[model samples]
Each structure stands twice: as structure tokens, then as C-alpha cells.
Target: MKTLISGGTVVSLDPSIGDLARGDVLVDNGLITEVAAHIDAPDAEVIDACDRIVMPGFVDNHRHAWQTAFRGIGSDWTFPQWAAAMHGTVKAHYTPEDVYIGTLLGRLEALHSGVTTMLDWYHVAQTHEHEDAAIDALTDAPGRSVFCLGAGWGGGDSVDDDIRRVRARLSGGGRIDLALGMRGPGATGIDTAAREVKLADELGLRISLHIEAPGVITALHEHGLLRDTLTGVHANGIGEDELRLLADAGGSLSISPDVELKMGFGAPMTGVALAAGLRPTLSIDDVPSVGGDMFSTMRTAFAAQRGIDGGLRSRDLLDFATVDAAASMGLRDRTGSLTPGKDADIVLLRTDDVTIFPVTDPAASIVSHGHPGLVDTVLAAGRVVKRDGALVGVDLPALRTRLLASRDRIAEAAGVPLDGTWRPQP
Candidate 1:
């Protein structure tokens, strides 16, 4: 199938193409065929981009997708309180069905918001059934995904079988990749970190570590477990040296400002990561307390970055969401910029929306004024997952019903009633 997105401002993040005031993008099969000023593909399907800001689809570096069922229940939670509640009762009651519902909700919501590629930091695999449910939901979604399999905070048996099963299941050509959702050195000791990282390396899977505190990278590096395939999440409290260490080791950092600042994890590492010569990727982290929208993630990151480094620009943040983000997931060769020969992971944001009508600068408009509502169309792997401002093939009512049932059952089993504003009492 051939599709030509004709005549709009195209912000291809590809340095060669740059941003075109008026451009056209042609997609054949599942890859971008051409990005030029004009493309005369008479037989192809034409998507009018006259009022759209066409760009590469957003890539999220880190997200706890299974927490979608508990959205906003931790709004007033601190790091400690949230850990206790989220990792304690609710997690214990999670069944295979609950994980399936949550993963479906999260992945679908992510697509609606123009996030085509994401790393699901999955850690609720209490049993093989739970693992199956999560991976099944990932395959069911119409987007590029990385299943970062993890053991829960309480620690479980070897995840080798689960990881191997997933790898074998998704071995052939598809949109999903496998990774290790590790606890890292700070949370787990060095010996355990080394052991797990070695296993990931042997299996050829990327490692996504939660850099919970400072010196985590240093400690891991000292143990010779730090590798290029590692991606550190929430390096909020880490120092500049730690950032440099990560960069020197050829690893990437994912800054989730919303979760960090709100959860008292200290300030975002956006500015420092940049200063340390590392292109930091951005993510929503977890939607349990925040919305699963990449626009919100970009905006929060922009605000936090600009506050620390006044010279920060919207295009830089856009790069973090697009190209840099894909690099973090180790899928740069596949997606992340609107370049020819790359996967057609694209998003078309309408510039005619009430808040976006006066599109002065295209990239700036997307980073600053853009919202999920402005996302008029999205194409993942050259397939139209969302078009005309609605998700394709998704039953929202049915999904909501299933989600509610799952939440209710989990809450009941955990003996914790979920209130609209469930918080830690003084």
C-alpha cells in the first residue's frame, strides 16, 4: 500500500530534511519511501496534510504500562507512600486478567496520544499467566513496543524462562522488542545487578534500569555490568558525574519530570544530561499519577528544562521525544525521524485547533501548544492506527468496562478500597 501525505509543514527531525514549510511524505509498504516538496504518486491514497503538522511519531523511553488500571490513584502519594501502596496490596492482588486489561488500556491510550513507540517497563509478572497476558496485550496493540520484562520489587524466581518465551514468541518480524526491566545497582545489590545484566547480554536484550538514587551508575560501572544497551530511568537525583559515566558507557538516560518532581524524586536531570553530552530521552514514566500523553510529557520536560537552562528550545525537546527517544529504546534504526527507508511511524497534528490555529513555528507549536486533541491522525509502521482524531478498531466502552472490573476485583482482593482520592493519611 502507498500513502502520500501531501502539502503541510513537515518536521522530519532528520537533519537532512529538516523542517519543510510545505512538504510531502510518501509511504510504501511499512517504510517511508520519500520525503520531498512534491510527490506525484497518482495511485496512492492521499491524506491531505494542508492543515497538519506532520512529524515522526513520539517515542517514550520508559512507562509502567500495567499501572494504567490504577490511574491517578496515587495523585497525592510521595515516593515512599506510593511504593508501599502500589508495590504492596494492589500488586499482590493482580491476576493475569487484570494485567491484560491494564496493558491494553495503556497501549491504546498511548496510541491515541501519538506515541507510536514505547518501552513498557513491565514488572508485575507474578506468574507465567501474568507474563502471557501482558505480552498478549502488547501484541494486540497497533504500535511499536518493547517488552522490558521485570521481576516485582518483592523479588521472584528466575525471569529467564519468561524472557526466553517472549523472545521466541516475538522472534520473527513484528513491532515488539524484548528488554530486561531491571532494578539496577541502587535498588538491588551489585552482585545481583551483575548477574541479571550478564543474562540480558547473553540473551541479547536491552536493559532498562531504574536509577533510583545517585551513584547507581558508578556502582554498576565499577562492577563491569554497565553496557551500551543500558537505559537509565529517573536519574533525577544523580549528579553530573553519574550522567557523564552513563554517557561514556554509551548508555542513555530517560527523564520523567512529571513523576520525579511530583513524587519528590528531586528535579529532572534534563539540563544535566544535556550538559553531560547525553541526549536524554523523555517518557510519561507511569500514568498511574499522570496522564499517558506524550504531549504532556514534552511540555513538562520543556518547563523543567527551561527553568534550569534558559536557552532550551522546543525543537530540542521535540528531538528528545522523537529521535533521541528511539535511540534510548535501541530502535533508532527502525523508527524515530521521518527519513526515507525508516519505518512509517508518523503523527499528524492539526494546526487548525482552537489553541493551535496561529502556527508561527511548527516544531515550537508541537512542543509548546500541542495536545492529544490536536493529534488528528497517526500511522504506526505505515498502518493507520488512529485517523480523524479517533483510535481505529478500539472499543472504548468495552475497554472501560473491563478496566473497571479488573480494578474492582484487585482492590477487593487486596482489601484496599479504591477511592477517587486515595492517599496516605497523616
Candidate 2:
């Protein structure tokens, strides 16, 4: 199928093609076939991009999609409090059905907000059934994703078998890719981290780690686990040497500024990552405590960085969520920019919206004033997942019912109220 997006302000994010004040894009067979000021495709579906900002869809490099049902549950909690509530209490009550619903809803929300590709750091695999449920949700969703499978709080007894099963089942081929989410040295012991790294390497899967401490990077490097496929998430307190090691090893970082600030994870590592020659990607992390929109993530990152480094550009933050993000997830060759031969994961933001009206600088308008509601159309892999500000093939009312039921059941099982005020027992 061929689709032509015409007459939009194109922010291609590809330096070679550059941004076009008024341009067109052509997608053929799920790959971008052409990106130019004008394209002549006589037999193609025409999408009018007038008064819109056409760009590659945001790529969220890190997110916990399995916690969608727990949104706003930890809004006022610190990191430790959140960990206790989620890992200690709530996750213990989540059934496979709950995992399925939450994963599906989270991925759907990402797509609705112009995030076409996501790296779901799904640490909710309590059982093999739970892992399967998470994969099923991503497979059912329209957007592209990397399912970074990991054992949640109480699910590590048979994690190796479960991981192997998931790899065998879903690694064949599809939009949903497989990755290993490892609890690195800081969270787990060095021996456990080494074993997980070895398992991931043996399985030929990329590894995602939550870098919470300073020496975790050094530990991984010493174990020969700090490679190109290792993505460090929320690298808060790591120093220059650690950053240098990551840069030298070609490892990437995923920073969730909103969650970091809200949960007191310290100042964001955006400036430090950039200084160390790492094009860090932005992420929504867990939407349970904050919103799931990439626009808010980008805006928050931009503001935070600007406060630290006055010379920060809005376009830089935009890149953190777009092209740079795709690269960090090892998806640059596939769907970062609107480059010919790349997958057509694209978004169209309504320039005529009240908040974005009279768009002067396209990048500035998007990074500063844009919101999820301004997303007009979203196409993932040449398929229209969202058009005219509505998601395709999604029954919101049905999803809401399932989500509410799952939340209620999980809350009840956890012995907590449904109003999200649950705390871990002393």
C-alpha cells in the first residue's frame, strides 16, 4: 500500500533531507519511499497534511507498560515508597489477565499520543503465563515495540525458562522485538547481574538495565557486559568516568526526567549524557505516577536541561524523543527519521490547534507547546493506528471496563482501596 502525505511542514529529523516548511512524504509497503517538497504518486492514498507538522513519531526508549492500570497510584510517593508499593505489594496481586490489560492499555496510550515505537521495560513476568500475556498485548497493539522481558518482584524462580520460552516464541519476526531487562549490579548482586548478562548474550538479545548506583557501569564493564546492546535507564548518579565508559562502549541511556523529578531520583542526566557524547533518549518510564505523553516528557526534559545548561535547544529535546530515541533503542536504521527505506512511523501534529496556532518555528512549537491532544494522525509501519485524532480499531469503552475491573481486582487482592492510596505494610 502506498500513502502520500502532502503539504505539511515536515521536520524530517534527517540532516540529509532537512526540514521542509511545506513538503510531502511518500510511504510504500510500510517503508518510506520518498520525502520531498513534492511527490507524484498517482495511485496512492492521499493524506492531507495541511496546517500540520509532519515528523517521525516519538520513540520511547524506556517504559513499564505493565503498570498502566496503576496510573496515579504513586503520584505522591518517593522512589522507595513507589518501589515498596509496586514491587512489595501491588505486583504480588497482579494476575496474568491484569498484565495483559495493563500492557495493552499502555501501548495503546503510547500510540494515541504519537509514540509509534516503544521499548517496554516490562518487569512484570511473575510466571510464564504472565510473560505471555504481556507479549500478547504488544502483539495485539498496532505500534511497534521491543518487549524487554524481566521478572517482577516475585517472579524470578523460573525466569530463565520463561525468558527462553518468550525468546523462542516471539523472536521469529514481527514489529514486536525481544530484549532482556536485567536487574543490574546496583539492584542485584554482581554474580546475578553476570549471570543475567551471560543469559542475554547466549540468547542474542539486547539488555536494558536500571543504573541506579555509581559503580554499576564499572561492574558491568569489568564483567564484559557493557556493550552496544546495553541501555542504561535513569542513569542518575553516575559520574564522568562511567559516562565515558558507556560512550566508549557505544551503550545508550534512557532518561525519564518527569519520573526522576517526581520520585526524587535527583537532577536528570540529560546534560551529562550529552557532554559525554551520548545521544540519550527520553522515556515516559512508568505512567502510573505521571502522564504517558511523549510531549510532556520532551517538554520536561527541555525545561530541566535549560535550567542546568542555558544554551540547550528545544530541537535537542525533540531529538531525544524522536531520532536520537530510535537510535538509542537500536532502531535508527529502521524508523528514526523520514528517510527513504525506513519504516513509516510518522506523526502529524495539528498546527492549527489553539496551543499551536500560527506556528512560527515548527520545532519550538512542538517541543514547547505541543501536547498529546494536538496529535492529529499517527501511522506505525505504514498502518494508520490513529487518524483524525482517534485511535484505529480500539474500543475505548470496552478497554476502560476491562482496565477498571483489573484494577479493582488487583487492588482488592492487594488488600488496598481502589482510590490508589495503598501503602506497603510495615
Candidate 3:
């Protein structure tokens, strides 16, 4: 099968290919075959890309997709307060059905927003059935995903075995990949974290974890567990030494600027990461407490980093969500850039949209003024996931009903009110 996206401004993100003001992207058998000024494939389905910006789809490095149903539940709460409300109270009430609904809904939102690849930090897999439900949701979603199976809230004793079980069940490769999510030394202490890291290493699985302090990275280094496959999430409080250590170890960092700013994770480490010779990826973190799309994340990261230190470009912000993000997830060779041999994970934004009209520079316009509503079409692995400004084959009304019902049931069961407002105790 062949598809030709014709006559658009192509932002390949590949230094070799560069950006094409007017070009066509040719996809054959789920891979981009060519990107040039003209493509003359006679039997291909032609997608008109005129007056649009065609670029590689955004890759979100970290997100708690299971928290989708609880959106806006902790808008006014701090990190500790939100953690208490969510992990301490709400997570206990989620059924396997809730996990499925949340995961599917979140991935669908990613597709609608031109994010074809996402790293889902799913921590709601309390039971074996819950794990299966989460995996099923990822499988059903029409995009590439890395599901980082977590050690549930408060941690789990059998987390190693749980990871092994998940690996054995979903062993093969496809759009969905498996990773281990850990709480690191802060929550689990060095000894337990070391054991978990050893187990993941033996299983040959990539590891993702939260790093609120420099001590966590020190612990990983002490245990000799810091490597390229280790992705440190929220490296907000880490100092220069820690950042250099992480960069030297070839480990990636995921910075969620909006969540970090709102929840007091300190300023995002974008400038610090860059100065430390690291290209950190951007993420949405928890949608319940922050915005859920990459556009907001990119904009927030760019502005926040600039406020910390100037000399950042709109292209740099876009890279944090695309090429740099794919590198963080170990997917650079697969789907980051619109290179010829890479997977056809692409997003087409309408330059004619009200918020993004008068496209001066394609990359700048996308990073500075892009929104989910301006995403006109999205293709994942050469398959049309979103087209003509709508997600294909999705019944949004039905999904919304199911999600609302799940949210209500969870709140009622947990004995918590569903009010969106949060008040701090004096």
C-alpha cells in the first residue's frame, strides 16, 4: 500500500533531509519511503497537504494515563495533597474497568492531539486483572505506546513477579511495548530499589522512575543500575552534579513543566539539562492536575526555560516533544523524525486555522501557536488515525458517558466528593 501526502511544508526534523517548503511524503508499507519536492506514484492514495504543516507526530515521554478520569480533581492541590487524595484515597476505589476506560480515553486524546507515541506511566494496576485491563486498553488504542507497568500506590511486595508476569503475557513486539515503573530510592529505599533494578535488568526491560532528589540518582549509580535504558522522570530538584551524572550515564530525563510549576516541583530542568549536555524530553505528567497535550507542555517548557535563561528557540521546544522525546524513549530510529526509513508517525496541522494562520515558519508556528483543535490530520505507522479534524472510528459521546460513570462510581466508593475545587488546611 502506498500513500502520498502532497505539496505541504514538511518539517522532517532530520538534519540530513531538513525542512521542505513544498514537498510530498511517500509512505509504503507503514514506513516513510520518500520525502521530496515531487512524488509521482500513480496508484497511491493522495492526501492533500496544501496550506498545512506536515511534521513528525509528537512523542510524549511520560504521562499517567490512568488518571484521565480524574481530570481536574486536584487542580488546586499541591503535590503532596494531590498524592494523598489520589494514591491514598482515589486509586483504591478504581476497578479494572476504570483503568481500561482511562487508558483508552487518554490514548484517544493523544491521537486527537497529534501525539502518535506516548509513554504511559500506569500505576493503577493493583491486581492481575487490573494489569490485564490496562494492557488491553493500550492494545486497543490506535497508536504506538510504551506501557510502564508500575508498583501500584504505596508500592507492592511482588512487583518483580508482576513485571515478569506482564512480560510473559505480552511478550511479542507491536505498537505496544512494556517497561518497568519504579518509585526509586526515595519511596522504596536503596536496598529494595536495587533489587527491583536487578530484576528488571535480568528481564531485559527498560526502566522508568521518579527522581525528586539527587539522592535517587546517587543510589542508582551506587547500585550500578544507571544506564541508557533508565529514564528519570521529574528531575526537578537535582543539582548540576546529578544532571551531569545522568547525562554521562546516557540516561534520559522527562520534564513536565506544567505539573512541576503547579505542584512545586521547582522550575523545570530544561536549561540545566541542556547545559549538562542532555536533551530532555517533555511530558504531560498527570492530566488530572495539568494539561494533557504536548502543545501545552512544549509551550510551557519553552517559556519557563527562557524565563530561567534566554537563548531557547521555538524549534528547540518542538524538538523536546518530537525528536528529543523519541530519543528519551529509545525510539529515535523508529518514529522520531520523518526520515525515509522511519515509521510514518506524522501530524498535519492546518496553517489556515484561526490561532495559527499566516504560517511564517512551520516549526515556529507549531511550537508557539499549535493546539489540538488545529490538528487537521494524524497518521500513525501509515494508518490514518485522525483526519479532517476528527478521530476516526471513535464514539466520543459514548466514551464520555462511560468515563463520567466510572468517575462517579469511584468517588462514591472512595467516600470522596467529586467537587473540582481543593482547599488547603490552614
- Reference-based lDDT, residue 21, model 2: 95
Q: How far is each candidate from the true structure, as Cα RMSD in Å?
A: 1.4, 1.5, 1.4
Model-by-model lDDT, in order?
0.87, 0.88, 0.87
Model 1 alpha-carbon miss at residue 299, Å: 1.1
**Candidate 2 on 1-426: residue-level lDDT in tens?**
899999999999999999999999999999899999999998999999999999999999899988899898878778888888787788888899999999999999999999999988887656778888888999999989999987664223435776788888986798888888888776667777878888887988888888888888998888887888888999897887788899899989999999999999999998899888898889999977899999999888888888986867988888888888888777889987999999999999999988889899999999989999999999999999899999988999999999999988888887877665566553
The 10-residue segment of model 1 with minimum total lDDT is 417-426
Number of colliding residue pairs in model 3: 0
Q: Tens digit of lDDT per residue, candidate 3, span 263-344?
A: 9889999888888878889899898888788888889988998887788999888888899889888788998899999999
**Candidate 1: RMSD to truth:** 1.4
* Two-way TM-score contest, 2 vs 3, winner: 3
Tell me the deviation in Å of residue 383 in model 1.
0.6
Q: Give me the runs in candidate 1 sitting further than 4 Å from their true place.
A: 154-157
lDDT of 1 by residue, 192-257 (tens): 788788889998889988887777888887888788999988888688987898899999989888
